[model samples]
Target: MTDLHKHDRVNPLRLPVVAVQGLWLRSTLRLASAPGGGTSGTAPGPTGPPLRLAVLGDSTAAGCGVTGDDEAFAAGFAQEVATRTRRPVDWQVVGQFGATARRVRFRLVPRLDDDLDTVVLLAGANDVLAGRGPSLWREDLTGILADLSHITHQVVVAGIPPFGLFPSIPATLGRYLGERADALNAVSREVCGRNPRTTTFIGSPAGTPPAGFFSTDRFHPSAQGYRFWANDVAARLLPAQPDA
Candidate 1:
C-alpha cells in the first residue's frame, strides 16, 4: 500500500516507547565437524537464537490491500527470517501510509528502544507521490538513520520499485513516482555505504514493473511481488560472512 503521511509538524501519531533487547540477529546453521569446549576460544558459535527486528515504513508495511495483517510485507519478512535462520524472531511493526522520513523520526523514532537489532525501511514512495522534493526526502532519511544509530544492529533500505508502469495510475504521474523512487534509492544507498553495518537497498525483481506487481490500484504489491521482495532479502542475509 502506498499510504500517505500528513505534512503536519505540530502533531503526529506518537508511537509508544518500549524497551526492547537483542535486535537484528543473524542465525546460521552449519554442521560441526567436532564439538569444542564452551570455555575455549575455539568454541563453536551458537546456531539458533531469536533476533529482535523492527519493521517501520509506510502503507506497504501497514498491510493495505492485504487480506489480513499477516499478509503484509513485515509479516512475510518475519516468517522468511524465521525459516532461514531457524530462530525465533520478534518483530515490531510501525507503519503509516504516506509517511515521509520526517514523520517517522517524529512519530516513531522516539518510541524505539536500544535492543532493536534490525530496522527495515520501506519508505520514499509516498513522499514522491506527495510531490516532496528529493533533497527533503534525503535529509529526512539521513536524520532518521542518524538517530537510529546504536539502536539498530543492522540498517536495511528497500529500493523503491518502478511505480511509473502501474496500469491504474496516470502515465505521467506514475513516471514521476518512478523517477522519485530511483532518486531516493540512490540517496539511501549512499547513506548505507557510509556506515559499515548498514545493508544496501535491494529493489524488486528484475524488469517487474509496479503495475504487474501491485494491486488493482497499481500501488500496493501483489503476492508474487512480495515473493520477489523476500527472495532479494534472503540473498543478502544468506551469506554467512560479508566482510570475509
Candidate 2:
C-alpha cells in the first residue's frame, strides 16, 4: 500500500493499547499554569515602541509545560526578537490546552488584537491525536491563515512537533502519531506556500533533543526546549544584521 494508505490504516489490535496509554497520560499529566498576566504581556527591549506579537493556538501557544509565562514559548520568542531587533515586544497569547486547528480558527482567532506586527500559530497536534484526516486539517488551517494574513503582515505557522520522539508515548503509538504529524505538516507547507504573508516555521533542532528538552510529562516542551525553539524562530523572523 501507498504511504498515505499506510497512515490511514489502523490495526484493530492496537486499539486497546492506545486507549490505555491515552487514559494513563490524561490521568497523570497536568497542564502547566498559564503566565501570570491575562494573556498579554510585554518583554522589554532596548528602545522604541514594542513590536506587537500574538501567539495563538494550542497548549504550546498557551505556554503549558513551562514553569511560567516568562519561560514559555511566546515570551521566549518575544524576548529573542526584542534582543535581536533592539526593540521592545508586546506579546500576547491566545490559546487553549487541547485546541485543534478548527477550534483556533473559530474560537481563538476572534480574540486576536486588531493591530499586530506578527502572529505565530501553534496547532495541529490535537487534531492528529483526534484522528482527523489531512483534508480536514488542510481546510481548517487554510481558513486560519486567511484570517491571520488579513490581520497581520506576517503569520508564522509552527510545524507539528515530532510526536514520534516524544518520551511519554509508546513506540507504536508514537510512530503512528508521527506519521500523522508529518502529513499535517505537509499540508501546512502547502497552505503557507500559497499565502505571501504566511510562512511555516519548521525550526526543530537537528538530531535528537538533549536532556531537559521536555518537561515532566514528556509531551510539551520544557524551559530549555522553549529557548531552543524561540531562538530558531527568532533567527528566521528577524532580518540579517549588517557587519560591524
Candidate 3:
C-alpha cells in the first residue's frame, strides 16, 4: 500500500490509543497536583561579588514537578554555579507553564531586569506540541535570545528534553513529537552558535530516561531529575570550574 493509504488505514486504530493516553495523562496530573511555582534565591558561597542569573522558558524552567523552588532546575543550577565560583549566585526564575516561545517573547521577556549576568532558557516542548515548524521556532527563539542578549552578558539555551521517552505518551505520537523536538533543537543550536554571547546546552541523552527521573505525571522532571539536569548544564556553562 502507498504510504498515504497506509497512514489513513492505520489512523483509526491510532486515534483510540491516543485518546486513552490523553485521558490517562489528565487523570494522573489531577491526582499528582501541580508543582509549586517558580523559585528565586541567593545560593550559599564565600562572600564575594554575586553572579546574577535569570532563568526563563516554560514549565520545565519553572520547576513544575518539584515541590518548591529549591528543588527546581533554576535553584539547582544556581547552587551549582555558587559551588563552582565560590561566589554567591543571585537567581530568579520567570518561567511559565505551557508557554511557547512566542508567549515568552511577548509576555515574559519584558519582565527581565537589566543587571543580569547570565540567562538560561529551557523551552521548545510546548512549541513542538503546538505544531510550530522549525522556521517559526527559529524565529521566535532567536528573537528571545536577541532580546536577552541586551540584558545579560551570557545566554544559555538548553536543548529540549527527549519527550518521546515519556511513559505517558503513545509510541507513535512520541516518535512524531521527538522528530519535531530534534528539529527545534537544531535550530536552537544554530541560533546559539551564531551569537557570541549565547551558548547551547544539551540535556540528558536520547532514549528512555532512568527510573525516578520523571515525576508521577510521567512528564515534568522530578527533584532528582532537575538536579541531574542542572549539573549537566553547569558543566557546559562553567567547564573550567571544578565540582563543588
Candidate 4:
C-alpha cells in the first residue's frame, strides 16, 4: 500500500475522537461570521502602474479569521512586496471558506484577472480534511497550476499549514490530519517544481504556535499569525535584491 493509503488508514479506536473533533470544528465554523465587503484593494508604492496580484484559495485566502482584509495574508504580502520592490500592488482576493484545491481550480481560478502579475494559491487543507488521497490532491493541484500558467508566469503556492499543532484539535486526530497535510504538501512541492514559473511558499518551520497565533476559533490564523505568515511568504515570493 502507498504511504498515502497508510496515512489514510486510521486506527478504529481513534474514529470516535476524530468524529467528535469534526463536530466541534463544524460548530466553531458555524459560529464564525464570514468576512464581508470588497476583496480587492491596492497597497501604495512608488509611481508606476501597480503590480497586479491575486490571492486565491479557501478560508485562509478569504481572510476569515481576521476582522478585516487589510490584516489578512494577501494585504500583508502586498504591502511587503510594495515596500521591498517599491512598486504599487493591486491585490485582489478570490477565495471561499471550505474550498478545496479542486474547488479553487474550478470556481475561483476563473475569477482571476487575466492581467495579474502574480497569483498566490492557498489551498489543500480542505482536501486533507475531506480525506482525499495524494493522487487526487496531485491531480487537482496539477490542474490548478496548469490553469494559472495561462494567466501569469508567477504563481506562488503556499504549503498547507501544520494541522498537528492546532490548539483546537485533539492530539490524536490532529496528528492524523497533519500527516495527511504533509503528504499533500509533498505533492504540492512536486507539482510546483515541474512548473518553471511556480514557487511553493512553505511557511515557517513546524512548531507549536504561540498563544494568539490562532483566532478565537483556534482553527484559523489570527491577525498576528497572518502577519508572520505573510512576511515569510512574501520574502520567498519576491526576488532577492542586491545589497547597495
Alpha-carbon runs more than 4 Å astray in model 1: 1-47, 209-212, 240-244
What tens-digit string does per-residue lDDT give for candidate 3 at 11-61?
466655545565555455432335463567889888689999998988888
- Once superposed on the true structure, which residue ranges of model 2 sit more than 4 Å away at CA? 1-7, 10-38, 239-244
**Per-residue alpha-carbon lDDT of candidate 2 for residues 1-244, written as tens digits (9 for 90 to 100):** 0122233555667656656666666676565545322377888977788899999989888877866658888888888888888889999999898888989999999999987889999888888888787999989988887788778878888888887788887776677777778888888888788755456555355678778988876888888888888888788777755543
What shift in Å separates residue 72 of candidate 4 from its native position after superposition?
Answer: 0.9
lDDT of 2 at 169: 77
Q: By how many angstroms RMSD does model 4 differ from the true structure?
A: 3.6
**TM-score-better candidate, 2 vs 3:** 2
* Candidate 4 clash figure, as a count: 0
Candidate 3 stretches with Cα past 4 Å from truth are: 1-37, 203-208, 240-244
Model 4 ranges off by over 4 Å: 1-7, 10-16, 20-33, 36-38, 201-205, 239-244
Per-residue lDDT of 142-188 in model 4, one digit per residue for the tens? 88888888888688888898888887776776777887888888888
Quick one: how many clashes does candidate 1 have? 8
